[model samples]
Target: MTWRLFRFFLFQLAGASLGRFLFRGSSPTQGAILGLLAASALWVLIDLRRGARLLLWLKRGETAVPARVDGLWGEVADRTWRLIRAREQKAADSEARLQEFLAAIQASPNGVILLDKNNRIEWCNETAAVHFGFDPKKDVMQHVGNLLRDPHFAGYLAGDDFLHEIVIIGPRSTASRPVRLAVHLHRYGEGRKLLLSRDVTALEQAETMRRDFVANVSHEIRTPLTVLTGFVETLQTLPLDDEERARYLALMARQAERMQTLVNDLLTLSRLEGSPPPGSSEWVSVRALLTLCEQEGRALSVLLTDGSGKKHDLRVEDAADEEIAGSQAELLSAMSNLLNNAVRYTPAGGRIEVRWQTLPDGRAEFSVKDSGPGIAPGHIPRLTERFYRVDSSRSRETGGTGLGLAIVKHVTQRHGAELRIESQPGQGSRFSIVFPAGRVRPLQPV
Candidate 1:
């Protein structure tokens, strides 16, 4: 720039000398006047050049501009370039930091999504895509409401309230497997919003189990305690005969047994929770498990007389080729529970059938079918839940702790097996534990 200014001044000086030599005739005053005009013109040219350089830099991109110029113009141009470079460097650094932060968030387990002012998806992490059943690339710029059309979520976005989140059940969730998501949205930066999602099915189920467990424990204890209280009051206050006293004592004993059974079930559940999955070292035979069930059914039948005072027939179907790899005690407990349930529910002279068979795919199934009043379709799904009962009065009469199916379910899970229930209201129920191929073994007949 300085060079440019100097060049301009030199051109002005040459013009001034030429004019003085041609028209001034050695007049010093005239020479000085022309020189001043030339100098003013030079300054104007320099100013113009500086303005042009600034415009050129803007048009040509920052890197195209030269680092230095001649004279005073060079000083101004260099200062301007430094200022522009500083601003750009700061911007680049800020952008890099922002990108790093976003990358970190993208890798998080919890889902993260950003929405524009129009509520369209601007950016979303891979986790968010999986949670929402979305293709990240495809779903960008799509409206959040359009993509997630759950009524609760729609209402959440539409209403003024912004405090709570919504739980959305995935389309793929089923009885065998469940997928649950909790989604929340928060507004920021004018009208833009941030959405987060988490897989909360396990947590939700745990909370529900805790509540049900408390309720079940209270109900179970209260029933026995109420009976004990009544019997104690009867013995203490009423002047009863010797037979009456014996009858009341027997009733108290039965209640005590019921409470004891409930406590045992609770302990079994705790053990299942704390213990690791069963190892393959313990091989339990199918015949042995069925035989145990048969014995238990017979014993329970003696004590259990139906409304008509007749005993039910307990039959164990022999499958010679099937054995299971699991703890004998756990296998016995599971088989016993199913058999007991069948016996307790079946009416007088009703037949209870226990069958074991191997599937074509190498899986083994132990099925208990009874000729009794079957469960409703709705109750079938929740039969494995601890303390769930179809008929509380009947369950109590049968001396059931209501944890039979729950125990069976946990045992099956530990053995990596599946529990399937098929029932009709009047056709009786079929409860089966479908063992995985790994746990099932073939028995060699002698």
Candidate 2:
């Protein structure tokens, strides 16, 4: 400011000096005054020109400092340019962060969506698109209620209460392959909302299975317990001869044995589920496994025939010189279950064949094929479910605990094997377990 003031005064003095030199012969005072006025006008004109140039730079959207715009105008240009650059950098950082947030949401297993003030979808992740059967690109600005159309969800959104989540059938759900989703919404930004969804089909199915298991176990145990109670009462209240007493005792013992078998099967299933997968360390001879299966099948056949003189035509095919890796007890248990099931279900004089063969790919297959009252196609898939039965009364009459195939399934899985079941209404069933190559090997020479 001092320099500008000094410069202004200096220009006036220089103008006065020039005027005096040129007009010394005329009025020197008037000439000096006139020179000062002329100098001030020129200075003002130059200042206005610099201000105009800075204004032009701004109007052109240029960020660079304007050239020849010194004094106050120059400082203004530099500061304005720096502020513009800083804002641009800030905007770039915000955009990058937004993209990263969207990418994270897209990768999430759960779905996420953003809605505007009017409940229209502003943005949604890919998972959200799948959950709602929406095309993210085309669904923008579409109303949330219009897309979902679930009455529960519509009411939840319409109401002010968003404190809880709701479960709804997914848009792509079907009768057999049902899909379920848990959804919740949160109020954010002013009148806007954030929606979250997760697939809960597996969880719901597990819960359903748990309920069914509890009910089945209670009913199974109650039937035998009721019979035992009734027999105990009769024995305590009635006067019977030795023969009648002995017969009643035998019947009581049979019910007790049935209860005991059911308990043992339940325990086996629990152990299989709790225990880790069997390792491929201990080896059992394939011949030994086949012998054990044959023994179990024949014993069951005899028991089921009960001196009827019409025994099952049971056959055990010769086994190859191979060894199976893992727990021998578990392997025999699984093999026994399949063979016993075949024997118990096959009618008198029906054919039952057990085979153990190594495939060309080095995997070993242990199969039990029975000419029983063949299972229906629908029941074949769920035959391994605990306590599942095609004919509950028939199973009880045959002394089956209804957990045989479930045990087989668990053991097969633990040993890294696959269980396959094939059956039609009239055709007999074939249950097979194919052990992985890693668990099957050629028997070593003695």
Candidate 3:
């Protein structure tokens, strides 16, 4: 400031000295005063020129300071440049953070969408796009309600009630393949909204399975209990001959055994779900498993025929002398279940073949091919579901617990194996468990 003032006064002094000499005819004081005013005006013009340069630099948004500009304007330009750089850096950082947040949302399993104040599509992640079949590029700024087109969701949005979520069928949903989404909306900035969605088809199916399981269990237990109750009441209320009493007792025992089998199957399924997977440290012999399964299958066949000698043409072929690496008890139970199911389902004199074969690809497969009435295409997929029956009456008549295939599936998964079912109506059914090469090994060094 002192230097600026000194320069101003020096200009005025130079102007006064020049005026005193040049205008000697006039009074020196008057001449000097006139020169001072002129110098001051010239200084103001130069200052304005520098200020104009700074304004131009700012208008151009240049980072570099204007050349040849000095004094207060220079400092102003430099400080302004620094401030601009800082602001630019802060904006860039915010953009990066926004991108990172969007990336995280994209990777999320659930769907997310950002809606504008007018409920238009502002932004959405890939999951949301997939959930709603949205084309992000084309859908931007489009009205969300128009795209959704669900009357329930439109009403939900209109109602101004965001306390709960709603489920809607996805665009790709079909009768054969179902897609259910759980969606919720929350109010955000300035009348904007955040829509979140999750694929709840699996959860819905699980809940359904749970309800069906409870109902089936009650019905299964009730049927046997009813028969047992009737038998007990008859024994208590009437006097009967020894043969009649013996027959009634035998029938009662059969019903009790059926209930016991159902309970055991349920317990097996629970244990498979609760326990850790069976390890490969314990080896079970394939031949031994086949032998046990054969014995049980034939015995079950005989029982089904009521000792009438119209047994199935059952064959248990151990073509490969392989060892399956897993719990022996579980392997035995699984193998026995498959074989017994074939025997029970196949009619008397039908052909039932069990074989342990090694696939061409170093994998071992245990298969049961039954020449019974084969299952329909629709029923094959859900055969492993608990209590799922193609023919409930026939399943009951065969004394099936309806949990055999479910147990098989669990056991196969635990052993790192795949349970495959191939069947067509009247062409017979083939159920196979393919063991991975890691789980199937031949006897080592005799």
Predicted structure with the largest lDDT when compared to the true one: 2
Model 2 segments more than 4 A misplaced: 1-71
For all candidates in order, the CA lDDT equals 0.85, 0.90, 0.89
What digit string (tens of lDDT, one per residue) describes model 1 on residues 259-335?
99999999998898799998997777788778878888899888787356677877787777567899998889998
Clashes of each: 10, 0, 0
Show pairs that collide, candidate 3. none
Better of 2 and 3 by lDDT: 2
**What TM-score do all the candidates reach, one by one?**
0.70, 0.87, 0.91
Off by over 4 Å in 1: 1-104, 116-120, 129-193, 199-202, 306-309, 443-446
lDDT of 3 at 228: 100
lDDT string for model 2 (1-446, tens) is: 78877888898788777776667788888777777777778778887988899888888887643345877677787787788889888999999999998899899999999999999999999999999999999999999999999998999999988899999999999998899999999999998999999999999999999999999999999999999999999999999999999999998998999999999999988988998888777888999988987988898888899878898999898998899899888899999999999888888899988999889898889999988889887888799998999999888988998999999999998988999998866678899999999998889887
* lDDT value, candidate 2, whole model: 0.90
Cα RMSD of predicted structure 3: 2.7
